[model samples]
Target: MPELLIDIPSTFVERIERLAAEENESLEDMAMLLLRRGYDFAVTRPEVEPDRSQRPGARSDARLDWWREARFGLFIHWGLYSVPAGVWKGRDWPGIAEWLMYRAEIPVQEYEKLAAQFNPVKFDAKAWVSLAKRAGQKYLVITSKHHDGFCLFDSAVTDYDMVDATPFKRDVLKELAEACAAQGIKLGFYYSQTQDWHHPDGDGNDWDFDPAEKDFAGYIEDYVKPHVRELLTNYGPIGIIWFDTPKGISEEQSRSLLALCNELQPDCLVCGRLGNALGDYATAGDNRIPEEVLDLDWETPATINDSWSYKINDHNWKSSVDLIRKLVDIVSKGGNYLLNVGPTGEGVIPQPNVERLEAMGRWLEVNGEAVYGTQPGPIQGRADLRTTSKEGVIYLHVFDWPADGQIRVEGVAAQGARLLAGGAALPVEVSSGALVISVPEEAPDEAATVIALR
Candidate 1:
């Protein structure tokens, strides 16, 4: 957990290459082995314990408190790939922005050319955090590094990062951290574990692979871990280290990484993608929310559109009402919803994405009371409806309102009821062991109607 900058010896790289050939292992495997040894050594080596000031709370217990309370967050997937803005050469790329190179099978050198022109002149950290705050997002998770292997932050470990390589030389992560601090939004970093095909050690394919020439494991030790240390130490109190791609990581290595985070900032949260349960919360990928999330902490990440990164031709963005419904649905099921927004290459979130968020913000302005501080219901209701509770009051969110001004809800024996939208006293009576209430002639909102019960 030392904040010292990593300095790898030139001979170390040669040794790694030699070791890989001797073991008949791929460079990636050798890199993992070296990293495992380095991390193990770092953790076990004795050093003077620094001042305990600003240290985080117990990892196991502190995170649960935050997890249960944070019902909604904003997931941002912006990077150099956004600069391509979903276009390769002169034609439009069909896949996501991050995958523009891979999907198009563009040569690494060709994709690297985009980096020279990558400049987010309109990038405004304050504006970005303000949007998330207005949308009622309690936390913000930005992609610090994606599968493309480009680092968003300024890492001394490599020149292939945002600060040194791209035209936009500012530390995006640093500015974001400052903005989140100013706005009181918890900040988290999403780090992809897999290296990109563009890097030197990452050039091999599944077929006709050779391990002698490339030292993949050395890259992990010399590049990845050191960069992670820099991130944890430099970024003032990152709330979470959201790791991705545990494909090559071993349980021991994962545990060591988690331990490093805990040692550096004990309160920092980690996600389930870190190989073992080393992560504090379980993550459900895009649009794949669980019907019954486990009793433990969990979150579901989904995009407003089909892709995580902005796609010009991708017109499948979810409406504000749909996004709000999804948020309510997830919260009612005891989970946090991390809705994603992909900004264009010039550092502007598309007009459609901004419009949807604004609309959702308006709805939240009125209905946030039932969401912000509420806990999940004791019993999940029917498919068309959901429930959340605050104090002794239960709020039933009816997704599909019944016609004929009558709605029947089971399992809740309520003594009194009221309409949350209008605050009008509702007449509730029990019949045949079910609670029946009179619905308004028309729905308060086209999306869903919330009824408060005590």
Candidate 2:
């Protein structure tokens, strides 16, 4: 189908204006709806959703079709950093544990010794996948190789990998992939494309390897590209290749790797950090969500706790209510939420993270229709009420439930309304250009109450 270019007739404009006035929507918004009606496709008010995914453009968008629908994902950051647990020299280190190597300024020789102690005996891939699945995450992205150059998967390129170096000589990634497949969850790899602190030719090791002596291109060809090839071919149908930290990768260098990924798995999406701004979907700033609705498929990677990796001292965990609200906010803005959990050295998800995930899962069990496979509603920027629509039904996610029985939707008209948590009919009235949904005095869920508007 061609793009939806609305060329409304002069006579139709008057009719649309009346309808817009009735719905409290802009005349232009109603006109877009009329235009899209002639051709079936979703249209966002204020701005029409462009056919960036299907039309002739970057191949990334084409592959992002499934990702947009996913809406939620699990991000695992586990490695030797888990061994440190944010402690260096018996002193508590601050910030993310994944940055342990750089933060503590540990040399390659000393850091290599930690692998011998890297025995995650309790690490069960099935359990991890099950946890993520229960949390209602459509996909899981684990750190295959972080900036520290410690490989979780069996890598032929270096002896620094789990299989080659670790005491628990099992391929963490292989098990994770198999487990994800068995549990019917999509899996992706978060490979550190640049800034391999352990490798001499890799970026971000000025103390160990001199920049002048390092061969950046050779590092890409020998280690980075080949390792990526191994991951793609070995893993069964990867959803994404999440490359992170663009230290020194040029545009051409990044494209070369993306091309390799495309050749291997045509549908595999690349992270936005895959330097040169070439990726399947846009990645929002770490732990940051959009202020308003976004037309493109973007994702916000958030940590369950203060640190991406486990820290004994980092007790600051996001409450269940906060996580649920964040999820709702991201979904309302037409974006996916990739919540991170850093496992302990023993490869255990912290108890706090587990509890919060279960809580979110329970909420999703009831009000999932408002999230999964839903598109952004016509209403864009509003904190009090966010919108997401599926088919013709619009979902009003009320952040602050109305104290009074009457719930007024400023610019929406609903045929009928029902509270999502419980199948109770919400008395709905379509007044002059507004939708009023009647609810109980007390809100069902304090976090975010969803009302289904048809």
Best by lDDT: 2
List of clashing residue pairs for candidate 1: 27-216, 27-217, 28-216, 30-217, 31-217, 31-218, 32-217
lDDT of each: 0.77, 0.84
For candidate 2, the 10 contiguous residues with the lowest summed lDDT are: 45-54
TM-score of each: 0.83, 0.86
Model 1 scores a TM of 0.83
Tens-digit per-residue lDDT, 1-454, candidate 2: 5666644334446667889999999986787777678566332212211211212254345467677778999999999989989998897876688887887668899999999989999999999999999999999999999999999989888889999999999998999999999998999999998889999988887667777899989999999999999999997899989988775678789789989999999888887778666767767767877678765667888998889988989988889999999999899888889999999999999899999999999999999989999988878787687889999999988888767778777777777888898789878877776777778999899888998988
Best by TM-score: 2
Task: List where candidate 2 sits over 4 angstroms from the true fold.
Answer: 1-62
Q: What RMSD value applies to candidate 1?
A: 11.2
